[model samples]
Target: MHEMAIAEGVLDIALDYAKQNDAKCIREIGLLIGDMSGVVVDSLTFSFDMIAKGTLAEGAEIKVKHVPLVGRCTKCGKDFRIEHYDFWCPECKDGVLKIVSGREMQVEYLEVD
Candidate 1:
């Protein structure tokens, strides 16, 4: 699955950082995944576990933070959290919504020792 590639990329970055810092092992990996990022948490975690074998992050804990989708109404200038995938603004009814957030997948930080 695509999660395997994502996991491998994450591992490469983490490993590179750890090596640069002379870390013996990785303790934790903090991830920020947006609702619209399309990265499955369980699948990504499983892939990471599988790929981390015999590496600095072999036993590292993965912490995931989910970011909700937010949008701003173009007509009413109102900002709201999107519950469903509807692009219509709830307050203005006729306004088109511009997505503000929730399309990101990023590694926030890593804990290494």
Candidate 2:
């Protein structure tokens, strides 16, 4: 699965950072994943667990923060939260929407000892 690759990347970053800081071990990993990021949390967690073995983050707790979809109306310049995959603007109703959030996949921080 693609989650394996994703997990490998995350593990690489965490290990590199831990080595740089001379950490004994990783305690926690904070991730920010948006609704539109197309990543399944459960799958990612499982992949991470499998990939992190024998590493500094072997027993680290992964915390995922979900971000809701948000969009900005191009015509009216109004920002609103998107629900149910609707991309239309509520105010002007004819404006094209540009997604402002809910498409990100990033590591927020790592708690290392």
Candidate 3:
């Protein structure tokens, strides 16, 4: 599954940081997942448990921070929360809404010993 790859990548990054910093062990990993990032949180967590085996991040706790999808209206310069596939502007009821945030999946922090 793609989530396995994503989880492996996350561990790879955390290990790289640990190696660079000479950390003996990793306590936790933090991630920021945006609503529009197309990542399944449950799958990611499960894959992390599998792929983190024997790595520096083995037994490390994963913390995910969910970010809401936010869109900016092109016509009226307004911003609004987007639910599902609807991209219309909330303030002006316009169709020219551009995505300003969300659509992100990244490691935000790491707790190490």
Q: On residues 1-113, what C-alpha lDDT tens digit does candidate 2 reach at each position?
A: 87777888889989999999999999999999999989999999999998899999998999999989999999999999999999999999989999999998889999999
Per-residue lDDT of model 3, residues 28-105, tens digit only: 999999898889989998999888888778899999998899998889988888997798887778768788879888
Task: Give the Cα-based TM-score of candidate 2 against the true structure.
Answer: 0.97
How should the candidates be ordered by TM-score, best one leading?
Answer: 2, 3, 1
Worst 10 residues of 2 by lDDT: 1-10
| Lowest-sum lDDT 10-residue window in model 3 | 88-97
After aligning candidate 1 to the native by TM-score, how far in Å is the CA of 72 from where it should be? 1.8
The superposed Cα distance between candidate 3 and the true structure at residue 70, in angstroms, equals 0.4
Local distance difference test, candidate 2 = 0.92
lDDT (C-alpha) at residue 54 in model 3: 85
Count of clashing pairs, candidate 1: 0
lDDT on C-alpha atoms for all candidate structures: 0.92, 0.92, 0.89
What stretches of model 3 exceed 4 Å from their correct place? Answer: none
| Cα RMSD to the true fold for all candidates | 1.2, 0.7, 1.1
